[model samples]
Each structure stands twice: as structure tokens, then as C-alpha cells.
Target chain A: EADIYQTPRYLVIGTGKKITLECSQTMGHDKMYWYQQDPGMELHLIHYSYGVNSTEKGDLSSESTVSRIRTEHFPLTLESARPSHTSQYLCASSAMDRNTEAFFGQGTRLTVV
Target chain B: AQSVAQPEDQVNVAEGNPLTVKCTYSVSGNPYLFWYVQYPNRGLQFLLKYITGDNLVKGSYGFEAEFNKSQTSFHLKKPSALVSDSALYFCAVRAKAAGNKLTFGGGTRVLVKP
Candidate 1:
């Protein structure tokens, strides 16, 4: 039983191609986050949204953009994919409470050739 | 800046043995601590958290964590290690002033060999 879902669990695309990674949660959480991780490495925050139409850049610099049009959906898009964009993208959501922990979705592994 | 530290990159333990994964954190005020486990190619699963309560917090899969305020540590422990317990563990921390953002430590891979 997965509360959060990510589409195209694995993806391979050519350079300059635009790709959108979809993440949807059924938990009705208000806060969502995007993290990028390489193999056997730490996860880096890239983007986050507190609610619909409220998005902010995270600690890491990313060419990808995200949109939160609905409470349950937060999708990340790479405007122009490059070789460096190859990595795993993870999505997480948490409750409005400050003490609550965030729940993560099975990541999307992207490879830009 | 709120940060979490998992000093050991890998921890090896034999089955039926007590296991511990160490974690320490730094934050301005009282800290909200959490532990998550990640299996191969899977998203992280929350194991336990320490918002405020007893120092010993129990969580899923027979895991427990001890929150030490003076030492600023929350170490995950299991009474007996199992081969199935082999996975990557992450420590996270968040301060009240940091909004909802959680800063994560570099993961520690735990290998429980039979």
C-alpha cells in the first residue's frame, strides 16, 4: 500500500530533451519536497512547496523546476536535460504539523545521455 | 544551520547481536529528530521520531532510538540484529525556526551478516 507514487521509475533520455517526473500523494499533505541523490550518496534538496502555487528553491542549485497545482500533486520538470542531470529524484510529503516526519516515494532514476 | 551527522559510513554486525547506529545533531533550539531506513532502490521509510517525550522512542520493525539532549544524539538501536535489517539508515533533524525543512545526514549502511 503506497501512499505516495512516482511515475516512470526509470527513464533514459537524450540531451536537450525536456522531461517531467510526476509525483502524487494520497495523504493530503500540505508540504512536499524534491530531493536528488546519486548512487551511494547523500540526498540533496532541490525544491519544495508548502502548498498549491507556493514553490521555493532548495539548498541545491537545479535547472529543474516544479509546480504544485493541487494539494496531492507535485511534479518536477527538467527544462533541458543534460548528462549531469542523471540521478535519482525522490519526492516526499509531510503533514502540517512541525513535529511530523516526511514520507518518501520510490524514486525515479533518470539518465540523460 | 541545523545538521545531522552519521559518522560511520558502514556498520557490520553479526546476527543475534545487539546493533546500534550512531547519530548526532546540531540545532538552535529543541530539536525534532527522526530516523529513516532505505532499502536497495526503495524510498526511505520512517522508522521513528523524537518530537518531545520519553528519551527512549520505539518504532517500526522492532527498532528503538534514544534521544540524548545533553549529548545531542539520537542513536538507533535494535535488541537483536537480523539479516533482513541490512539497509541504509539516515538521521534527520529540524528546528522550529527552520520551517518544515529537514536536514538529513549522509546515510550509514548497516550490514547484518548471518
Candidate 2:
């Protein structure tokens, strides 16, 4: 089984609340990524980090920010959640090598009311 | 920029029948392709990847993919799909020189009937 875990499997909150989604992997992977996906839809890459202190925005623009202070932990924070920001957030990790496939967490589904 | 495409939005097949999902990608230089499966409200699970070597790569759950470098395609297939295999499948691509970010295609929903 994949060791990656995302906390708060489901979250429902008010529009203006601040929220942080936690992602951690026991696999000690160097590359971590956060993707936004609607149910049964395409996945849009929002944020990814090559290693500690290295984060880059993905193909799609996103309002949330991510920090990779630790190799095993990559957290995404939304300053002020809005209804538009509600979606399924997936966290994945992969080794430094390009040949390896990424492992995903169970995902965090957020709903802003 | 690297991108992937899944032509079919949905594919239906009877149980114990052959299954195929089409995928095509574009990338500068060589490409690293991958296939992932998602079951309902869950995160994507890695199915398989084609980095190099053989054109046919086998992965989890009796799934396999064929990489056609000339056509820039990696299509997933199963000899006999089961009802439990029904799910959403995604195709992704990463270029060798494009860092480690993966570009995913629009998913394809697969339905297997018993």
C-alpha cells in the first residue's frame, strides 16, 4: 500500500474561512505535487515541488499556496476559501528519478458554502 | 509544453470482453508516459508507466499499455475486463527535459457490464 496520507478526507466550511490541507508521505520522495480535480473530470496541476524549499506553479493557475519545508510533508493553504475553490485536492509523491510512477493519497474533498 | 489527450469520454464493454482506452501525447524530446485509474471519489492510483525499453508494459490489475513512439501514443488495454474494473482512467505525460511535472489528459470513464 502507498504510504502517502492526506488529512481531513472531507471538509465543508464557510466561504471566507482559512483552510490548510495536509499531505505527508512515509516513502521519503523528493518530488511532491498537488492537483485539483472535479469529480469524474480532468486533473489540473496546481502546485508541485521538486524538493524542500522548492515549489513551482503548475499548468493551471491556482489561488492556493503550498510549502515544502520538509521532504515528507507538503501542505497547501488557501488564504480565503471561496465557493469557486471547492474541489477535490489530490496529493502525490514520486522519487527523484524520472522513471518512477507517482503514488497518490486518498485525497481531500473541500466544499465552501 | 507537454500535453495529453484522451479521445473517448466513455467506453462500455461487457464483462470478459476486451477493453481499450486511447491516449495520445505531445512533448518536446522523448516522453515519459503513465496511466492511472480512479475509483469514484478516490485519488488516482498508478497503473503503469513507460520510461523506456519494451513497447508493451504490464501494470497492476492485469492492465497493460503499449507505447508507440512514432505515433506519440500510449494506449491502455485489458484482455478480459471485469465488472470491478469499471472506473475513470487518466493518461499523463512528462517530458524528459520538462522537469518532473506531469500533464494529465481529460479522464475517460470505463463501464463494464456483467
TM-score of chain A of 2: 0.98
C-alpha RMSD for every candidate = 0.9, 0.9
Runs with alpha carbons beyond 4 Å of true place in candidate 2: none
Model 2 docking tier (incorrect/acceptable/medium/high): high
Q: Per-residue lDDT tens digits of candidate 2, residues A1-113?
A: 79999999999999999999999999989999999997658899999999999999988899999999999999999999999998999999999888788999999999999
- True-contact fraction per candidate equals 0.82, 0.84
CAPRI classification of candidate 1:
high
Residue B70 in model 1: lDDT: 93
Worst 10 residues of 2 chain B by lDDT: B94-103
Instruction: Give the per-residue lDDT of model 1 (tens digit) for A11-55.
Output: 999999999999999999999999998687698999999999999
